[model samples]
Target: MRKKTPLNKQIYLSDHYTGNIAKTFQREKDINILQWDFSVEASLVVKLQIESLLNYIVKNVKSKDERRCKYLLPLQYLFRYVKKNNITDILKMEIRQEKEYELFVPKEVKKNSGSLRKFIEFCRRILFISNKEIDWSANVWYVEGLHINPKRVSQGTPILSFSFLDITNSDNRKALQEYVNYLICVTSMKMNTIRIRQTYARDFFRYLEQCNLCIFDVDYQITVKYMKKLGTQNLKSQSYNIKLNAILEVIQYLQTRNYIARFEIPVLYHKEKEIHTVNDIYNIDEKLDILQKYLYLFPETLRIMCLVLINTGVEKGKMFLFRDTDFYWEEGTSWLRIPGENRSIPIPSILYWIIIQYMKRNKLTFDAQLFHNERGKKYSTASFADAVSKQCSKLGILDGEYIFKGSMYQRELCRVLYRSGTSLQAIREYMGYSTEEVVKDIVGWKDEKVAIKTQEFFEDEKHNLGGKLLMAKHDKMKEINQLESLHKVDFALQEIKNYKDSGRIISVTELSRKTGLSKGFFYKNDRVREALDEVKNEQKEEQLGIIRKEIIDYSLEKQLEVYKRELEKTKQENQLLKRENEKLKKALDKQTLQYLKLLAET
Candidate 1:
């Protein structure tokens, strides 16, 4: 039976940006009398003509023999139309249907077009008619349906053949189908990925057919030739690279199985992904702008998702992978685990309340998967991304430079902290990435301690940065030629010294702006850093020498004064002793005069 809304079709339409049609398909349940399977046996000619389509659909949909099989619903109506209109009679069909079809019995029809456009596409696949042979004006739905040119997704069945893949080689087609099925079931790949791979495979296979070659004939040279043409597309490096890799994977798979020769795949360098700088981390204003919707107006589901993404930095897949038990909320404290991130992290009270309310509404228990898609199946990437995307657009915050994924949340959140003087280590721990490098790549803060140390000099309003800081260090000016390896010990040291001498450093970030180098660059450049250290030591020694000289001058002056006082006192004492000696001699002389003999005897 036809579903209320087809999940795979929703993903298909969303990925193609097939916006309103999906709603049209689901909401406009205009007719209910149509059967969902063919009752009459197909004529021999019709059966022979649709042999491949039938075979493909049979393999693709296992419930082919069952009544009301969802995939067969559209086809059952198609067969009824074919027989009712006696369409086999063949008209010039030179005139387009004003509307695609007008059902006879109920005399009702879809306002736009019947499912004729889809039927025609199915016919083309069955018959292998080239695009050029098809008449565009014959179908009323031509513009609305075909103009968008949604890719014909491969269904892991050998129903349709690309020109590049040999039409006569039934084995190749079967193998490709088997491969696609394996990818879907065993690889646990996402549906969107399956569609994309299908699209890429079609393009590559068609190109191979044009070149008069097959997978067996493929080599590095052929792939290189293909890439040279691929390089012409106006996609961004990242997008272009992803497309290239998709094709490479197909070829690589073939090579791994010894069906083709092995070769190294080319790699593209998208400079923007290198790492987010401190700048990519947003300031308070930006953070407030992004987070305010979650705080107040967004739906509960979206709010909780945004909160978790903002807090834990987990991607959509892993964010949805969590069970209720992963969240530990009780009493006054709360935390949750994002598997593979290694530890639990504290959550805000508001988030806890939101999750509890959501769980209660959904009747979720501790063991239930906390999130799911609309069909009550496991959470799907396309649905979650679409939900987030719509909200971001409504807020008028979507930007071409950044995608609003979980990683972007991390970058912006970390940026806010970085701007506010939060340490890198703290931000990294909070972000929950396994490696510091991953945090650094996402938000480039190389050293938590040194990253923002220079901020104080710029913080003080009274100091003239050019005059009081760099100029004094350079003896008067900010000329690069004049200062040779003199100022950098650590990027932080200059900031530290600036803070000490001038009592202000606005931010390491501001100093980084002044120097026109990333904060991480100064922190990470080892070769230049060693020289910077030597220069710092030299400056320290010179300052120490001047202090030492002043102390020696003061000490020597005091010692000289003490020596002079001691000499003077000694002289006075010697004079007194001399006087006493003279007195004694005079007395001796008088005594000698009185008693020359006594004196001589003495």
Candidate 2:
């Protein structure tokens, strides 16, 4: 048989036990005595008497005696104590019935009764009341020292509170009182993003509290409630869904703190139609013109920040991290280096100059933050959002509405540049995006025309034709020089041939020997031999036609050169004639003035 584990002797006390055990016992004894006739008549005298005794002990036992009372006393012992004390006939029957109930009750019910029985035992052990002579009536009457009213809690308690009391009391609390202030005072996020984050966080918490559940016990029902509430509030589905996501983050935080047990948060779906519609470029231009008026009053840092955001589409938080060292300016190229991803973005020269002017006007030192507050601290995302909202409101752009920071503006600028023929790769590098999707969204195109044009411009046959023409001209000139030299040699050979024709025969081998020419030299002198043959055949029948063609080609080249010179002379004459005509007109006007003066004098 397996050995049974012993039961724990420790007794737990609940809210009921704030008084002395003796007084509680006496009250139970008195009630039992008064109700003895009814208890016996109903055959429940013993059960009723024991129940009263158990209630008394649990309610009034002192902290020290509480444990002993719970574990030592038995129902039979209580009956023996009543009999030994010679308790009245009325009480005897009632005590017997209590003993019978303990002996015959179901095990489960008896186990519950055991707590009361244990309390009595503990009282007996602590009070040193002998089991044989214990006066049940006297013990019951000794109930003067008990008091049992519960204390009321006055302050409101958070249903899902954590121990952030110390944090609340901290000095940073003043700075962190508002979401915007916290972001500005503690973190290095842009003001605009901080506002966005704050709006999301607020919407989330509001949704949570709005549902009547504690943050800890937020369930599917509460989520459903929030969804219904959101619908009733007439918020755009997208905006509502965004707030739901932000709220879910807070719920996740709660889960981390052991406040909630399950991960069953509901996700909100947004309709496509709920997304903000974009206006035309004309409206954007008008808005930009209105925004420019505020640049004079706003700090230079904020002015440049707005321009950079509108032009570049960098996230507001990322813009806060930008430093002067991030900019690379050399050889007419200006690029900004983004950390984290290590991407470099080329900026427009015009925007670069505007940023330089803004920096100079601010009297800021080089390497100082490009976008900072009066204290030279970067604006947090929330504060930047608030500032943007306020500026938009002042310009009548927002009109108590929320507007996204860079998306629409970036899309518009990208489209304009793309349509004007900027390359896709250039746009990708300019926008600091890792992928081309954003660029594609901004400027839809099958291919970049500028890149194709640049490629063709550099490598096209037409562009290389000038170099080819120069090479061909040089080759032709070299060939002409070689031919002329061969013609001179041919004339010398023809003179020797003339001597041979006059019966003074000169063999080729003899001519080669006389000129000290080797076999290789003879082969190379074929051009000279050919020229000599042509000279000899100059008066021969049909061979003169070939000579005549050569003469015609030489004459045509000479005429072309002469024509080019005549064309230059004609252009000069045209210019000279124009100048002479202007001078004659001036002289005529002068003579006419002189004649008019003479006429007036006459």
- At residue 159, give the lDDT of candidate 2: 16
The RMSD of every model to the true structure, in order and in angstroms, is: 37.1, 44.4
Top model number, TM-score: 1
lDDT of 2 by residue, 1-602 (tens): 21211122111122343234334334432232222122122223333444444445454455533323232244434544444444442222333444553554346444544554434434433342322343332222111111101111101110111011112222222212333333434566543344466555555454444443344556666656665666677776677666666556545655665655666743624222465665534455335544655556555667788777766766666678775555545444556676445577776545665665565676655456677766666677667777777766775654623344446666656765665457777777776667787788567553565777776684554566667776577578879988976775765576566754674443444455565553234334666556444544443324435433443443354456568778999999999999999999999999999999999999
Number of the predicted model whose lDDT against the real structure is largest: 1
Q: Mark the 10 consecutive residues where model 1 has the least summed lDDT.
A: 89-98
Alpha-carbon TM-score of each model against the true structure: 0.42, 0.34
Give the lowest summed-lDDT range of ten residues in model 2.
153-162
Give the alpha carbon lDDT tens digit for every residue of 70-149 in model 1.
Answer: 32444434445555544541111111221233342122233222454444455544343323443222221122222221
Candidate lDDT scores, in order, read 0.52, 0.50
Candidate 2 Cα deviation (angstroms), residue 216: 7.8
